[model samples]
Target: MPQERPVEDLTEADAKAELDRLAKAIAAADQAYHQNDAPDITDAEYDALKRRNRAIESRFPELKRDDSPSDSVGAAPADGFGKIRHEIRMLSLGNAFDDSDVTDFDARIRRYLGLPGDAPLTYTAEPKIDGLSLSLRYEAGVLVYAATRGDGETGEDVTANARTIAQIPQKLTGAPAVLEVRGEVYMTHAAFADLNANGPRTFANPRNAAAGSLRQLDAEITRARPLSFFAYAWGVVSEPLAATQFEALERLASFGFSVNPLTRLCLSPADLLTHYRRIEGDRPDLGYDIDGVVYKVNDLALQARLGFRATTPRWAIAHKFPAETAWTRLEAIDIQVGRTGALSPVARLAPVNVGGVLVSNATLHNEDYIAGRDSQGEPIRGGRDIRVGDWVQVYRAGDVIPKIADVDLTRRPADSTPYVFETTCPQCGSAAVREPGDSTHRCTGGLICPAQAVEKLKHFVSRNAFDIDGLGAKQIEMFFADDVLSIREPADIFTLARRDSSNLGKLKNRDGFGERSATKLFAAIEERRTIPLARLLFGLGIRHLGEVAAADLARHFGSWDALISTVDRASPAAERAVAADSAELVERARAADEGRRAELKKTRDAIWDDPPLPDGARTAWDDLIGIEGVGSVLAVSLVTTLSQPGERRSINRLIAELTEIQPPEARATQSPVAGKTVVFTGTLTRMTRAEAKARAEALGAKVAGSVSAKTDILVAGEAAGSKATKAEALGITVMDEDAWLALIGG
Candidate 1:
């Protein structure tokens, strides 16, 4: 046995350093034990290491790096999964402490764009599983490589091990020639239970069990673990998969990889919140452990445009669920001004440790959260019931800060008042508004609010927006505070290069830059002055106008000048024709006409359908459908959105300030059913089932989910299931995954 050192014997510095080293060592061991299911040390040793690391990090906050081992949340990406460098790194997200954190994140995004009040934005939320991140690569429809996500930039190779999982197809049918899919490798509660049932020792958790399985040195060992995969993302591939995040997951499932069917796409943040609440309610019923919910920009192009930050991407953020609950007395409540000028409430608690961290404050979330009453209807605190000196239960539900979950009336201090949350921006004293049916109170201060200015500036210069050089959150805040940059509005950012030279000179002297860098930054700013219409449109940070929408607008309008003139011309008439805005608006009219054309093309393109639709429809569909991945559904969506006059006018206005050129469209080969939906199912036994599907798809059929009335044909092999049954029921023809291959002349 290794001799254990007494904590009292070590110097403070030495203890901290030792703690850091131990944490790293333990994390590596966890990767080996959980991901690979191979452990180099005993459980006792691993436990000791963790205990020591926690003790040290707790005593020495300054010693912690943002990526410290103490913060490790999941298994390493599985080795044996095919590896590909990401086109854009799939970074992790920062955790939110409370409702304020979620609000702050939203505010930051808005401020970055210089969006006005009432600008609308939406988010898609999904559970953030505590599992290993694995990347799977496929070539010409066959699984090739599997690797673990290491430091985001690099990971250990683990292709053979990933092959052992059943849900992961050795070869995919009806997929592009090349593809690389990324997902989380997790263990269900039942599977983990079964794996440990006959074992001498039981697994502690799914994350641990999954880590152990994926870390196996030999692929055969990994085959025994009851590990499953749920693809939430992609690394990179030669061709596009789907336009939206929801569609992308469906595409991954079509390729025979398991995806979490629970994923949902919502139209607004309010809808997203509803889903989050539902998930919270059902968390205990879920078979896997989830620490947080990740909300991401759904459109792939928008995601790409948003890009990444140092450790996380700007397009996505994680709203952590409370992990645990604690009890403490509320000492006081403090209001803090966020970068977005939203006044957030913080409950100061008598110092109590939760989740091993000493916590003095819990987030009140918003006025609504603080003001809500219990069933008894007793003022829940000072005015609201969560008053000063009241006993409260604090929970660290995956958030950095805990939230007050309950109050103890018996222990409430006599001096406590019903807590009164404010309706004004604490920093700027601007009136705050709480819309009907909404849970949050928002500051209506807009750009004039100081707290929001710096945050907005940081967002405007974010990698996904303007992508300004040598400017970051810290720098933006400094400039705002020092009056070096009076960025009260989005347009103010365009004039930054022309600001006083002294400040610019001072910035150049900072650690990472010099005069040469300063000159280069200015040059970059000048270069961006002539941005493509789509980028400029995105940079404007218009409400609801993301990169893909911007691109669609640009393509629809063609040139910037045309878009602007049309918008300026349409504004006055738009106010009076609100109900028939689409009909009244030029863009809407074009889109509707285009949709009609697309519908006609669909009928004519159907070789398997009786009586073609029309010629005009075919031409309109041709012009509309040429863009990559713009299928029948998305094509319709694009047309429908355009049919709205106000949207068109807004897009046009944005175009006037920018110069944009739509990139060349991808040319699609003349494959059969070039615009049709086809489904293939059952056990295929000729030249490998995967090969047949790929060959058929090469001949041009729209491969799709389940056999339906709309399906052109069903490819079936021996013993097909619901898909085959449904096809026959619907009068759709069926072919074996092999005979279907033969039909395509494979």
Candidate 2:
């Protein structure tokens, strides 16, 4: 094959061509690795292809292919194994590279909890076994099922294969009625060597050998392999196992599941580092392959408080070993567009091995990045511009994202030229303009752009959005391309089966679709007709409107019609108010008459001071912006998305096709502070202000920054100020921090 083009030399056309090739290559690799127990490329090479594809997609986010491998997990389950949907998701953990990263992890945990530096904190550290993650479910003390953590939410059933393992117990005496014990299943180094020497097929590593054995079609094959299991976590449980993580492991060990003997409880970061070092030193002698050490918050209560992000738990992180680096040639530069219209640049590098993996691509970030300037215009890489054909150093830490560390100028090709950034959308030919003070350049084509339209459709059916079971990104792309399901907007999805009903040839007869699967897909789409307001809003894919923001808006508006109408009226008025405020400033600067200027300013302020809201309207623009986490910038982005006539029409059409959009359930009224507006004033000695607000909000109270006539209660701490006075004057209930805490049973 011809050598790949240098990243700096790639045009938008070249980038698109390369993306297509990479997508197909990656898919085949995934199928070989997951479905066939045979991989065509090494792990490093596969990672490089994926990394390159992501870099291109990031640069030209709008051009991201529908079958993009970045969105997929492990390949779809092999044909023989039955699929099982997990009751609770098996999330992956973020990685920490070094000692500093571990320390940062601890510090971040403390910061998130609003705990002081001196506060007591503890963590449970254990070896991160390099093996297949397995979940064993026990019901009524009997082992009912065992599965692999395929994609975190769904997995293939390997209960028969699991039963063959000597370490996995068939029954537990003191376990919960419904408990899903999660851990690693691996073959020891000696067992792996023995299997390789005696078995019909050769194995690559202990992890692959264990995975291949457990995923076997024949139970006898798995039974013949000497595999071991280690229980470190639990998924769905009937009741609390223990007060702390360390105690929970001990509890699991008592139930007959093998637990790793190297587990330790550490009270400080220093202790965790010492333990990590000790484990790293003993890794070779442990008989099983271990990648690194995993640390989790000891207190179960704290873990609950930390909650989770999109795909990982906030309470835990895995500290990985240092990354290996390799020198590679700068092949080419590629730009990829995203759903949100961001145009990112990616570096395509000559294939080289880094550590154990192949390194072929790395992120170039944006135009400024390639120019060797940081976001703030500061020089980096010794102020050297990364040119095409220059030998570059690539480093892969625990993260899949590879970074360009340095360049060897001595290896630079003399004829190489500086890269010129694109000024137009490669897909729709629309002007690509970067906003002032922003790093990324966005396409002005909006929904008309094919790339943006497809992405938005993909987002509409994403896990956090409509979450249609059978309608994945690949399916959506296929349907969109074939015109069998042309989803130009979110509303287009619900109308697909209806619009195609009159056609003689149905979706079932189409390629890649069976009659039963097509029927099930339509049913999935129809089931989402009556979606929750928060999910619908999030599905719209508006900028800055994440899950949290959508929830806040839904709670504030209480209904779909209310939110739509409010945004319709408030956005225009808010626009005019901003203009009037600007005019008032100009008048104050130029006018000699102070009285007239003052009057103008007062009139401008009064226009928005008392909102003329319709009766039964629970929220106004001020109320929306006043929400604790919903800042003015986020509010503006929401209003802007709503202000577009086309977007508004599309939303209205979508609503017409769907059933009533249900609002979030109201807060429980059991607590005294539930549904009450609360204000905090002065310095709190017991806890930080943020923690106090969080606690109060958790109890269903709406914590406001300022006291108003609508304030139901005022929590005054030391040196209570004007807010306390204002609350007392307005006849709102006033109480000290201690009294406030007592009232809420804190």
Candidate 3:
């Protein structure tokens, strides 16, 4: 219920209250589902609650309580079965909803592995059974134990029940000396129907029938109900069964264990999708229920290279079938402001079941989307707008955010009025305006708006920013609201301890803080006084200046004073260049002849080449934009943030209060490419461009995108173009990918 409060309106007190409520609610649900085996809430409802908890925790990480549900897996083992602790944690696979998601999964894998786009990679695609996960242990080619996947770490031993299953092998002739075969314990639709009809009790679905039957306290009861096992994976093994995942599955089948017949090898995303479609087409006749298709990196060596994340293996993902849809009433539309001052609309809906999940809320991207206009300004839904009290179709496919798919005009309320978007900040009554070419409207109040202020402060101390040990989002909001730590800007954070020391009200006596915690917090703040220039720049929360860009700027300038002075001097020149570019664009648009338009376009491109400014100012402007990744957009963002009188004064004050930031350490001279400016171009065959750049930088080389007189080496790959030619013309060293690799001893 506390989550019903808009995220923007949630104060520190509200967040704490909501987190406590969610923790208790989720813990109870987990107990009922995992222990009692009789869930009070639907799976979708449970997922929604967990999703809400995660969202809130992300926004207020410092407020994550000792009993935070994010850290938990499943419920504790039930009382009946003996508890077996797993040697290797049985993690879950992340889900993908559609084709784009599956593609993204592949791209992410390639990125993590540093594989080139055209590199040969293979995957094993198999049907993801909708059943309870079971793990069977074998030692010396003989069955040792069997257990359920309970909370990923510990499970309830069901060796007696598992022994009765025909698909499970009691002894293996050719298998690893020590192996733990992990798979699903499922029941076919025919078996489920027959058992439910013959037995006194009925079942909801095949998955529930399988889980309930397998988890029975009496082994005889479990055996009486038809249960089957399919070995798809393994936990602990003395040695790998095969070089590839597909081969391993085949090997499992050869060892007298049942394996899913639909499993196959996929060389690309296209192949994976083809297999998924084939499975989906045959799903109705497969006798067993399958929710999706699971894809894993085929090569065991590649799988090892791509390790695991916190909860899921990086080498695997599940592409789920589209979720079932249901109609619900649109109760209300609420505008929520984000940390960046962008206003987003959320639709509150009457609860409806969608793919076994209870759906109540969905995102309405922006005003245009709500008004039936696409991002390209094209009409959608026949230009019909969604109004409150209208019947709307809601969808929830895999991990994708729930959304309103369609509206039913037949069920529209007669009295419903067209929704009006707000033009003023809902929290601070400031003017909200949309800029040219932007889809969403933003509040102009900046630091004055409570929503923006709280968000900015949160970013200032984020993990990549100041990263103050004790000051978190929740604490920041609490202190800001109580006026005990009035951090209107980043500078105020540094001055907090000094200001609090002189005030009658102190942090040590606060409700959540004691003398020790308060003191530790101050110490944490004090320790950050002598910070790195990159972190300090990033902590300012300047738009478009991310961690990488901040580091690039810091490396380019070498010191805080140098960066500040250069940017300050370059501000005017950059603004003039931007103005000139805009004017030339306007002239091009108004030009009557093609020749004149072409000339205008050429002039626009030349504006940055020779900007109208003093000699020193022009040089500063050129250097600011000449960094490897820094471009016109980022350069303008830096100049704009630094040019604002109020923001600049605040930054200057913050700088005065702290020690000067230290430049990054010089690269070691021992490195092969130390202090060299290296440029990479064209299609790299062995590795990705990102990987090449990372390798070069690790070897103490500065990797630039373009070749210039300063470039020491140009590593050209196949199809090398202008950069390679330019490098040769400049008399700089040019080497092919293989030659470059040999030079680095790759």
Candidate 4:
């Protein structure tokens, strides 16, 4: 197998090859979806592939193919139905998969219109119906023709089938002389289930059933299928409909068309986000399926100004909700040990398709999760425990990682039993202990366990870490297990060229590495001699440590020596806190008397207040904890893990190999919030949480996850709760959204 190349490093030739491959793959998927009404891939996966193609074309426009997926909409009209050429192209929207993407969409529109930052731009937020797109052309208040949105310019004539849907009126009472109502043709969840129960064939989903029923050769079959429609847009209109989208929707509703009642006029991105949340919460009870939410410029004039892109509209964006759930058999359960000695349970699933992606494995979270309980011992998934030979619902978390969402108790085999979680580490026989207030079980063997060592080494060379080219996960495993000239530690990678120059055989003769590849690997290693401070910190693979937290630490301390000293000084204090908390728990569990439990709490408080440590140990602990994102959990992870003898020696060896540790860049901002840790709580009315975080980061503020002794400021919104109280007790500055805006001079 060949090593995968990063898109950023791809040559023009490589780009062209990838584009060719994507075009073919996308064309096949489009046909399966639009033509056959049977999608092979999830909408998320398909969108990702298209996004990749578009990104490549943007970078290498000259190499773009005429048949590029970026220039197309749906597949050409299916065969059987007579094709109707659309008078005006049916618009397909660009997608925003997350909050940041939505924020960027808003910013892009403002920039295109040359509007000021404070300008209020409104949008119409509605559900993106997961159904077939249909165009109904009405001439002089009577329905003349109807077509499906096939390949944008043409469609399948569904005129006879269209007349059956009561929502799609045969004649509009107050409609334009020449109006083409563009909307969705769908089947409700109830209707779809009824069809599958009574009809000859079972459909894949509501969307597919709706499409297949509407496209039937006989209009009687379509009429019998319980079809429905929701008019949301117009394709070709003879006269003006309305000046704004909200008013236009109202006009359509007046013309005897069924419009979505959930649609709302949003004055800002925050309003749209709020509406999106509401709709997502209402999705399960909606009695119909909707994949995501769509936001369009409310003003028709401004929408025209924004115009259209090559394939999608610049003014409209689909904020897609990922991870469609699917059910499959729970084949087996396995446990995988991580670099930090954390033992994570993994579910081996009978292969199933979820959101167009094939899944065979999913994250089980922990033993408690499998036992139908959360970290707080609260029941989940209706208190149904997961067992082998049971049917499980798998969710594609963030549209990438698969996770077990629920289990079907009714489908469990009669002989099946609850899974027994391992009390000892599987790799090496050592006690795996689940700590107080912690969810995961951890191996006590440390690096003595082969799983921990190898996982750590792999993490060291991961893309976000050293990122050594040609040295991937498989190569790492091979080298770790090699009898001759094995690479066991991170330092061994830097010393390979030197070791090869000795009596050892050359790497060029190896099975996977030729002279060119070996030379390239060595060059890649050499290029990373001077490591970035954040990458080095992240490469350590400490429990609860992340890239963002590492960057925050690096930016705060500026150098390795400073970080080491702070962690070292805080170690005794952190150890005392953990020990004190554990002791309190032990005593309280044994105590039946309320007085005894209260006494134990006071004893724990005494230890917390005065832990026998060096004079500045308490202050150092506070400093470490105060750095936003690095609360007690991460602080303890850093101090306790690195202080271990084996980890210390390993880190020392790797540090010796580094030429330099480049400090993380600090933004030269003069804003008052810059370098301060700010925590936002309650309902933020001025902006969405995502927008607040991005704005804070831009001004060099560290947005902490929770309130702590080190928090510098707390921006409290309406109905402020525990965080605000804690901030007040800590003497942290508190302000409302309006005060925050004023202080920031916005």
Top candidate when judged by lDDT against the true structure = 4
- Clash count in backbone of candidate 2: 20
**What is candidate 1's lDDT per residue for 1-746, written digit by digit as tens?**
11112233233323333433454465667667645665665433443354455445434432332334444533555645444454445455655535765666666565544444467666668887877888787888888777777646566677778888887789888888878787888988888888789654677667778877777777787887778888888776778888888788888888777777567786555676677788878889998877667888777865654554344666777766644467888888777654334456788889887655567877675555566543233454444446788888876453223567788889877666777767788767888775664444557886667766655455455444566666555556665665554544544554667656675777687656688887787677656656655555444444334344455445445565555544444333222223223232444344555556654444333431334423334334433343322333334434444446764664444344334344313223575544455666776555344344334444544455454445778777778788788888888877665465455544
The residue-by-residue lDDT of candidate 3 on 1-746, one tens digit each, is 21233333344333444444455567778787767677776655555555555556545543443235554556778888999999998877766667986898899888867777899999999999988889999999999999888877899999988988989999999788999999999999999999888987998878778888888888899889999888999999999889999899899999998999888989999999999999999999999988789999999987875666445677998777765789999999988765567776789989887877667888776778788878678887788889999999887543224677789999898898988888988988888897777666778887778987887777677655677888877888887787655767778888887765653247777778887888888889889998888778877877666556677777667898888888888988788778777878688778888779677867766775564467677667767776777777778878988999998998899998787687877765687788888989988888778667767776778877667666899999899999899899999999999999898877
Q: What is the Cα root-mean-square deviation between model 4 and the actual structure?
A: 14.7
lDDT for model 1, please: 0.59
* TM-score quality measure for candidate 2: 0.76
lDDT of 4 by residue, 1-746 (tens): 01112344344433443454465567778889889998887777677667667666655543443335765788999988999999888868777777877788899888667666789899999999999999999999999999999988889998999999889888888788899999999999999999999999999899999999989889999989998899999988989899999999999999999999999999888888999999999999999989889999999988876676557777899888865779999888888876656676777888998877888887676777889887678898888899989899887633224667787777789999889989899999899998776666779997689977787777677655666878766778877887765788898888875665641346777779887887788888888889888878876766556555677788778899899988888888989878887888788888988779678978788887774678778788878876655777678878998888887998889899889999877764799888887889998876666556656777888887677766788999899899899899989999999999898776
Clashing pairs in 3: 44-357
Better of 3 and 4 by lDDT: 4
CA lDDT of each prediction against the hidden true structure: 0.59, 0.76, 0.78, 0.79
In candidate 4, residue 535 scores what lDDT?
78
Count steric clashes of candidate 1. Answer: 66
Residue 643 in candidate 3, Cα distance off native in Å: 3.3
For candidate 3, the per-residue lDDT at 547 reads 54
TM-scores, one per candidate = 0.43, 0.76, 0.67, 0.55
